[model samples]
Each structure stands twice: as structure tokens, then as C-alpha cells.
Target chain A: MYKLYEFFASGNCYKLRLLLTQLNIPFQRIEVNILKGESRTPEFLLKNPNGRTPVLEIETGKFLAESNAILFYLSEGTDFLPTDSFEKAQVLQWLFFEQYSHEPYIATSRFWITTGKAEENREALNQKRAGGVAALKVMEQHLTEHQFFVGDRYTIADIALFAYTHVADEGGFDLSKFPAIQAWIKRVQAQPKHISITQQV
Target chain B: MYKLYEFFASGNCYKLRLLLTQLNIPFQRIEVNILKGESRTPEFLLKNPNGRTPVLEIETGKFLAESNAILFYLSEGTDFLPTDSFEKAQVLQWLFFEQYSHEPYIATSRFWITTGKAEENREALNQKRAGGVAALKVMEQHLTEHQFFVGDRYTIADIALFAYTHVADEGGFDLSKFPAIQAWIKRVQAQPKHISITQQV
Candidate 1:
């Protein structure tokens, strides 16, 4: 059985949980409350040196960090990952974009606002708003032409992007203007075995 | 032949250039001077909606963006990428860490300083310093245990990380303390057909 070290409300963690559930892979969920600095503990650091949530213990001693990488690992040879080389790379393209371009702004802003740090980090939040909007605009443009992020099918790419994007409103991003993204969100939710971010497996 | 749209100095662009050269694959390098906002132009935006350099034209009208994704695409069948499932995912784990945990701090600081925006972004620079140092510390700890990022061999993970880390000093990061990383830098440079960041094909 896989042991997932995660924070429940975290979109990064939710990416893994949603995928695992959809794939019908059973796993043990161990909540590491990032708000309490539990991830920074020395023992947890052994599992992941970066001290972040969503570490998947593939076995008792072996582990994998990075939400997208974990998704890639678990989805291999399954329908969630495409077999074509180009399509696989395309899936990775969006995954990287989510980590570098999308998650930092959209997810972090939501974290700050929801964790009650918005007032203290107002300037940083202001700086992040533009980036969040830009990411959404990119998604909106892509979603306008395609049904899913890759190959017109619901893949882990959709799961990866949808985790935070569905909750971007909590980050103070106005998704009302991005009708394409709004429509795509509904498409993602309609997938088989779909689960919300807050759902416990 | 692949056509790489790139800015010469960028670590992201260098990753692809280094891999293409090492793999003995011929490619056309189309310089997109991001410093002058060339990447954001209407023409370039058609190549990559993200408006970023290091977009790989795999063939006519088929483009792939994100440097690590390009590396994964090109290195797929080669020894540059491991064939084993677990090792492949480990390579991706480092790639994600590079983009998320490492690049934002290490690479962005280098960009701000090298592009003469450090003075204006001093507050931001100060903020980034801690993150850069922390990333290096993580590298130091990992490199101490492994010769390469995964499978005890050089892979795209090294290429992805080497792009920024070798020039981290330009970002005002002190590398003297990370002896393991310094040694690993030399190891990466010693790879067969290795090319410097400034070297044009």
C-alpha cells in the first residue's frame, strides 16, 4: 500500500489524491499539517528533504516527492498517461507549467488568503494577482480550443491543473471572465470517479 | 531538424542546447532576445502562447515549450533518459524540484542582477536570497549522497538543474559553502560533448 504524506487543503496534495482515487488505487493518507510546520520535522525531512507535503511512500522505505512526478509515476501504463511520446511530453509541458507558472501564483495566493496571512502579505498578494490572472488567461486560451489539457481526454494534466484552478476564487482571482476555463472546470468534474479537493479517500 | 527558439544566455535555453549537442542531433537555433521583449511579440506568441523562449519546434507547426519538457522529449529514447520506470520518475522529481524549488529563486535572482534590475528590485532580491540559499542547501545534502541526481548516472535532471546552478553566483548566491554541489558542477561539465552556456551550435 502507498502512504501519502499530505495536507488536506493543499492543491498539490489534492492532485495526487484525485488521481489515486480516479485510478482506483487504494492508499493510506497521513496528514502532515504544513501550517503547524509538521513537514519541517527531521523525521519527515527524511521522506522529503524539501519539507513539503504530498510525498508518496511507494514502499516502506522508498518515496517520491513532487505531486506531478508522483502522478506521472502512478499513471504510467494506464489510461491517465498517453503512450505516444509527443503526447507524453505534452502532458509534462503542462505539468511543468503548473508547477512553475500556475501553482506558485494561483495556489500560493490562495494559501496566503485562506491561511489568514493576506493582511500581513498584502504587497506580495498584490504582486501575485497579476501572475494568477495571466496563468488563468493562458489556460482559458488553451481550454477554448481543446476539451482537455492534452489529447482531448481527461488525463493527469487535467487533474494537475484543475486542483488549484477550481478553487482559484479563494485566491481572489475573478474566474467569471474566463468562460472557457469555467466550462473546462465542468468538463473535468464530469470525469469518472471524480472527487473534490476536500474529499477524503 | 529541430528548431529551438531561444535566448542564448538563459539557463533554460542552455539545457536544450546542451542536450541536443550531447545527443549529436542537429538543430537550428533561432535566437529570441528575451531581454528586449522579443519573446512577447505577436509572432513569437504564435509559437508559444506562454510567450517564453526555449520553445522547441519538433517539426513544422508543432512546438513544445518549457525547457525540462523539451529535454524529456529529446532524451526519451537515449541513455540521457533512464528506461526504468522508477528511475524515470526520479528524474522527473528532480526536474520539478528545479522548476519549483530551485529555479524561481536561483535563476530569477541571476536574471534580475545580470539584466541590471537588481537595484530597482532590491527588496525582492533580498527576499530571493534566502530561497536561493535554501535550494543550494538541499542540493548540497543530496549531492553528498549521490554522484548524479538519479541512478548514479548523468541524465536530463542534471541538465535541467545545471542550467541555473552553474551560474548561481551571478544571482549573488555564494556557492563556496556547497562543496558537494561545486564538485557536482565540475562532474556535469565533464560530460561527453558538454557545451558551455554561451557556446552557440
Candidate 2:
């Protein structure tokens, strides 16, 4: 069984949990309180030198870090991932977009605001709001034309982006203007075997 | 032939250039001067709504954005990408690390400094410097134990990371302390058909 070292509140960690449950893959979830610096311990560092959560122990001692990479790994040869080379790369395009362009602003802002660091990060939060809004506009533009992030089907790309985007309101983002994204959020929730971010499996 | 819309100075764009050259794949380079807001123009926005450079035109009318995604697409089925599931995911792990942990700080700092905006963005630059250093430390840790990023062979992961890391000095990041990364950079440069960032095809 796969052992997931994760912080329960992290959207990155939730990406894996959602995928694993939808895939029917039985995995053990070991909560790592990132707020408490549990991930920075020497033992956890051995599992992931980056000291980040959502480390998937594929087997004992063998691990994979990076939630999107873990999603790619588990979804390969499955319907959640596309078989066509171009489509596969398209999936990856959005996954990278989520990590690079989307998550840092949306997820980090949510982290700061929800974790009681909002007052301390006021200037940083203002900066993040611009980036976060820009990211949402990109998604809205893409979602306006397509039903899903890749190939008009729900894939890991959707899962990756949806993880934080659905909760962007908590980050002080005004999603009311992004009707396309709001509609897509409903569509993602309508997927088979879908689970909420905070749902325990 | 692939048409790469890129800014020559961007390490993100350079990743594709290096891989295309090394793979011996003939590609047309269409320089999009991002500094002049070319990427944000309506016409270019059709190519990539994200308004980012390093958008790969796989063919006419079909564009792939995100530098690492383009690298994955171009390198697929070639020796540059691994076929094994685990190894392939490991390659992606590093690619994500590059974009999320490495590029945002190192590459962006280089952009700010090299473009002469360092003075105006002094506070932001200071924050980016810390992030860039932390990212380098992570790379140094990994390179210390392995010759290559994944499966002990040069892959697109190296290409993705090398694009920024080799030019980190321009970002005001001192590489003197990261001996492992320095040695790995040399190894990456020594690869067959390797090209410098500024070398036009």
C-alpha cells in the first residue's frame, strides 16, 4: 500500500488524495503537520530532501515527491491520463502551469491567510492577489473554450488546478467575476468518485 | 518543423533550444521580445493565453505553452526521456522542482537584475535571493548524491534545471558554495551536442 506523507490542509496533498481515491488505490495517509515543522525533521528529510508534504511512499523506503508527478505516476495507463503523446503533454502543460503560475499565488495566499499570517504578509498578499487574479483569468479564458483542461475530459490537470482554485476564495480572491471558472468548478465536482479537499479517505 | 516562440535571454526558452539542438531536431526560432510586451499582444495571446514565452508551435495553429511541458513533448520517445514509469516520474519531479522551487526565484531574479530593474525591486529582489539560495541548496543536496537528476542519465529534467542554474550568477546568486551543482553544471555542458543559452540554431 502507498503511504502518503501529507499535511491535511494542503491543496497539493489533496491533489494526491483525490486522485488516489478516484483511482481506487488504497493508500495510508500519514499526516505531517507542516505548520509544526514536522516535515523538516531529519527522518522526514530522508523521505523528501525538499521537506515538503505529499511524499508518496510507493513502497517501503521508495518515495515520490511533487503532487503532480505523483498524479502522473498513478494515472499513467489509466483513464485519468491521456494516451496520446500530444494530449499527455497538454496535461503536463496545465500541471506545470498549476505548479508554476497558479499554485504559488493561490495556494500560498490561502496558506498565509488561513494560517494567521495574513497581517504579517499584507504587502506580500497584495502582490499575490494580482498574480492570483491573473492566474484565474488565464483559467477562465481556457475554461471558456473547453470543458476540461485537456482533451475535453477530466484529467489530472483538472485535479491539480481544481485543488486550490476551488478554495481560492479563502485566499481573498474574488472568484465572482470568473463565471467560467465557477462553472468549471461545478463540472469538476460532478466527476465520478469526486471527493472534497478536506475529505478523509 | 517546430516553431519555438521565445525570448533568447530567457532560461525557460533556452531549455527548449538546448534540447532541440541536442536532439538534432530542426526547429525554427521565432523570437518574441517579451521585454517589449510582444507576448502580451492579442496575436501572440492566441498562441498562449498565459502570455508567457517558450510557447512551442508543434505545428500550425496548435501551440503548447510552458517550457517544461514543451521539453517533455519534444523529448518523448527519445533517449532524453525515460520509458520506465518510476524514472519518468522522477524526471517530472525535478522538472516541477525547477519551475516551482528553482525558476521563479533564480530566473526571475536574473530577469530583474539583467533587465536593470533590480534597483526598483530591491525589496522583492532580496526575498527572491533567499528563495534562490534555498533552491540552490536543494539542488546541491541532490547533485551531491547523484550524477544526474533521475536514473543516473541526462534527461529533460537536467535541461529544465540547467537553463536557469547555469546562469544563476547573473541573478546575484553565488554558486561558489554549491560545488556539487557546479560540477553537475559542467557535466550537463559536456553532454553530446550541448549548446550554450545564447547560441542560436
- Which candidate's DockQ is highest? 1
Q: lDDT per residue, candidate 1, B58-157, as tens digits? A: 8999999999999999999999999999899999999999999999999999999999999999999999988889889999999999998999999999
How far off is residue A172 in model 1, in Å? 0.4
lDDT by residue (B1-201, candidate 2, tens digit) is: 899999999999999899988889899999999989999999999999889998998889999999998999999899999999999999999999888888889998999999999999998889888789989998999899999999889999999999999999999999999999999999999999999988878
Chain A of candidate 2 gets a TM-score of 0.99
Residue B87 CA error for candidate 1 (Å)?
0.9
Q: What's model 1's lDDT at B174?
A: 85
Give one digit per residue, the lDDT tens place, for model 1 in A1-201.
999999999999999989899889999999999999999999999999999989999999899999999999999999999999999999999999999889999999999999999999999999998888889999999999999999999899999999999999999998999999999999999988999887768
Q: Show where candidate 2 strays beyond 4 Å.
A: none
| TM-score evaluated only on chain B, model 1 | 0.98
Runs of candidate 1 exceeding 4 Å displacement: none
TM-scores for all candidates: the values are 0.99, 0.99
True contacts kept of each: 0.87, 0.91
